[model samples]
Target: MNGTRGTIEIHLKELLEEAGLSKNKFCQRAELQRSQLNGYLNNTITRLDIDVLIRICDTLDCSISDLLEYKPG
Candidate 1:
């Protein structure tokens, strides 16, 4: 089998903008730390946490698909 790689892109910034929510406000509402949310917004998070994802989705009233995109590399 050939080995290939893909990327999971986080659209948190766009989603937050579209929802008219500031980063700080979102952090408060989602019960996430600013640094943690920054990691997700900047796409620098090495590990994905299910609980965090759920909180984000719940706070934004969005599905997981709306917050992430998979790109073939």
Candidate 2:
């Protein structure tokens, strides 16, 4: 193995779970496009739009820190 391989990850699924929100309900409540939300949940998103992130934070009553975590390899 080489050096450290790690990531600062968005823990969207866990936050959603803690909030008791289903994908569909969250989309409707947060006014997020279904595809975008799906992208995040599935970890298939390449870029996260800041506007959308703010909207989600406001809607969920969570700070950005609440949705993200840092892990070491």
Candidate 3:
């Protein structure tokens, strides 16, 4: 796979840090699994289900932009 194309990186940890929340609490509030959270943290996975994304945004009390970021090649 290309290093950049079609890849999405999420700054989930950074956002959570800014919000002063722990991973466990954030995951609980967001209703996301540990594996899914790890994937976003490690940048090893792309694509989020709409439901998950919505939950995260809701938990963070922010828009999608506040929880996620995009880098393009």
lDDT of 1 by residue, 24-58 (tens): 89999999999999999999998889999999999
Report the C-alpha lDDT of model 3 over 1-73, residue by residue, as the tens digit.
1154544567678878889999999898888999988887786764567898788888888888776665666
What candidate 1 gets wrong by more than 4 Å, as runs, is 1-4
lDDT of each: 0.91, 0.79, 0.77
Per-residue C-alpha lDDT of model 2 across residues 1-73, encoded as one tens digit per residue:
1126755677788889989989899999888989988877776676668988887888789999987666677
Model 2: colliding residue pairs: none
**TM-score, one value per model:** 0.92, 0.78, 0.78
Ranking by TM-score: 1, 3, 2
Model 3 regions lying over 4 Å from their true place: 1-6
- Measured by TM-score, how close is model 2 to the native structure? 0.78
For model 2, the stretches where C-alpha displacement exceeds 4 angstroms are 1-6
